[model samples]
Target: MAWFMGAVLLLALLTALLAPRLLRLQQERQERRADEHYRKQLQAATDHAITTAVRARLAEPVVDLHITIPMRVTVGDVIARALEDFALEVPWDHAAAMLRHRLEFRGHARWPDLITDVFDDEEDHTP
Candidate 1:
């Protein structure tokens, strides 16, 4: 009877000594899982924002043009140079004529005129 009681007391003491360590480990694991979940959510949101911005930028209208000019060298042969670029929206009507003049006077001739022609052509082609 005394031996049975002693074993029971020993088991209770061991359980008491180990319970706090087990509880602490479980709590740490839960916190780690929560942190991982939050990081994943933040990364997903950042990716979505970047994708949206890229799509918006791609949706903007862009035009590409290529120009070539040739020049004769004094010492040797002829040289040819090519220029290529893009143009965006430009308004070119009577109401916006002054704006167009200002832009052209600033040496943006090819760009402004090309953009204006594009808008005009689009309007004419629209049904």
Candidate 2:
């Protein structure tokens, strides 16, 4: 019948129109997953390198060192300030208090706990 033929033609037309879009969306999802995996891999590698360098420096002989601390502001904090009545500026000694708070509260939460792996020998250690 003509109606049955028209229904089949409409279904085929819809499939032809939607198939490429569906395929493109699937590809984009795959690409995003790949990007995230790559980012995590890169971060882990950077953390390892930094940890090794710090450990190597600490193992060296004592020397006077000067450190310039930076004020790191997060986007979450900025958003919170925009939403709430948070003070834009705190009282003096904020820097010192922040340092103390980080050392006391956050110092123990370091990941990959040991700087040097137990299985690593001095000769095979990364610097």
Native-referenced Cα lDDT, model 1: 0.40
Cα lDDT tens digits for candidate 2, 5-92: 9999999999999999999999999999976764444333333334444455557665555532222322222223323432233222
The whole-model lDDT of each prediction reads 0.40, 0.44
Query: What tens digits encode model 1's per-residue C-alpha lDDT throughout 1-127?
Result: 9999999999999999999999999999999997676444433333333334345545655554353221111100000000011111222232133323433454434432233231233344333
TM-scores of the candidates in the order shown: 0.46, 0.43
Extract clashing residue pairs from model 2. none
Could you say which candidate leads in lDDT? 2
What local lDDT score does residue 58 receive in model 2, on the 0 to 100 scale?
56
How does candidate 2 fare on TM-score? Answer: 0.43
Query: What CA RMSD would you report for each candidate?
Result: 21.6, 15.8
Candidate 2 — what's its lDDT?
0.44
The parts of candidate 1 lying over 4 Å away from their true place are: 1-3, 65-127
